[model samples]
Target: MRLDLGAIAKAGTSKANQTGSWRNFKPIFHQEKCIGCSLCKIYCPEGCVTMVEKKKYTVDYTYCKGCGICAEECSSSDIEMVMEEK
Candidate 1:
């Protein structure tokens, strides 16, 4: 059998997994610094980031792995990675 890597059979599977509890860090979205570039939503590996409005977005902690990719990819320094309290 051949393994098909990087192939997503379905999307939005993270909603059922609730993997945020395993994260050691969390991303904080600072709207004031956001430039509406949508980088965070585009770069999020877990697909937990979603557009809130035309130029705004929000993170869903339920499935966010806190990998910090979104924060690192933000050009305007809108997202910040912080220690997860829980």
Candidate 2:
């Protein structure tokens, strides 16, 4: 099936705006350490993290702001904080 690239792009842009602060903060997910509890996704104020697959989660950095809430909320220490270059 053919996909609407323009609609997808627009949706992506809109989602980015919803979490633009995340661009300043990057989330490092340690798969080996992650228990797949999804705590990080639950506590993210920006709601940036989403289930990418069965056991993996993806973080949307566009609005993350490096708040470290995900890291703090992570019970397994799966998520780490890194500096973003402006």
Q: What TM-score do all the candidates reach, one by one? A: 0.80, 0.67
TM-score, candidate 2, is: 0.67
What's the lDDT for all of these models?
0.86, 0.73
In the range 1-86, model 1's lDDT, one tens digit per residue, is 45568754567553677888889998899888788989899888887899998768899998888899999999898888999776
Q: Highest TM-score among the candidates is held by which one? A: 1
Off by over 4 Å in 1: 1-14
lDDT of 1 at 57: 87
**Cα-based lDDT at residue 25, candidate 1:** 93
Model 2 spans > 4 angstroms off: 1-24
lDDT of 2 by residue, 1-86 (tens): 56886645444455535455436657787666777889888888777788877667877665666788888888888788777786
lDDT of 1: 0.86
Error of 1 at 36 (Å): 0.9
